[model samples]
Target: MNRATLLTLGVTMLAPLGSAYAADDVKVVEKPIRVLAGIFSAASGANKQRTAIGVGYDFMKTAATNPTVYGVFLDYNSKKVAGVTTSLTGVGISGRFYLESANAAGKPYATLGVGSYTLKAGTSQSKIGGKLGIGYELNNGWLGELSSTMIQKIGGKDPGGVTFGIGYRF
Candidate 1:
């Protein structure tokens, strides 16, 4: 074969392979804000167990490797202490640190937050609180987490304890 003809054939044969590599290099663009909803089971300082519903939003565009999330939660139980029913409400802002790349499947993360918590019974009391948690997230946007929270004493009793939750990101 002539040299010019051989070079043309080689270039034509490799054209599709070069395009495939370019396609693989394309990166996925994610939405700036991700909304989430979930349910959590919590134990209070009084040793009462209650279930709660929570909702939150995550800021996807961050300088850090992980995302920052903000959340609001409410929980109540019929169990009365000293003949009084009690309920707790709170809002928190947390940051997640991923063990691996954010887009990896089955990724694990650690979270820390500070917030304000309120307790309501016959009267209402509010205090500052902090939370620490660990979680695992699937590539499909489902996550499970376990956390511990500590709220400053209200009327000489702590209002926070351990919580387990499941959430979905949208």
Candidate 2:
């Protein structure tokens, strides 16, 4: 009889502790502003490599497996690709979906972005383009990603290349 009473008391005491742990598995956020700034290393379709700096912010969040973010950013790429002199100024809307567990180690995410850009290659011309990439979010509030962006109407070429970036989520 005494053993049964102790077992019942122990179970009652541990149940609430287990429940508290479950609640901590998810991040409790009350509206967050996401911001990131990173440098882009790109290889254009013209077989040229260029570098650019980009900054972005996400103003909306949707609940699914985790928090999904959507916002906009600006990018500027140098015009020195494959010995061709040119530059690109771009502005676009971006979206990211976070998949996996969100914790101190953060999670993995995929991104999609669309924008309009002006290419300066002797003459200034405008085009519509987009970017796609995959990245990992670190627990230290930093992000690392590899992306590809494409532009239209530059020497009959598509300027899409891989970009490696490191930034922050705030």
TM-score per prediction, in order, is: 0.65, 0.67
CA-lDDT, candidates in order: 0.57, 0.63
Highest TM-score model number: 2
Steric clashes per prediction: 0, 1
lDDT of 1: 0.57
Worst 10 residues of 1 by lDDT: 25-34
Cα lDDT tens digits for candidate 2, 1-170 = 13344345335433433444465443333334444444454444442555666777665555445655666777776746556776677787776668875443678998877777777776788767777789998766777887777655466755556677777766
**Across residues 1-170, which tens digit of lDDT does each residue of candidate 1 receive?**
23354345334433443454455532232432333334334444553666554555553223334533333333322335777766677675555667777667788988765566777767988776666779887878788877776666676666776667777666
Pairs that clash in candidate 2: 79-86
RMSD of 2: 16.9
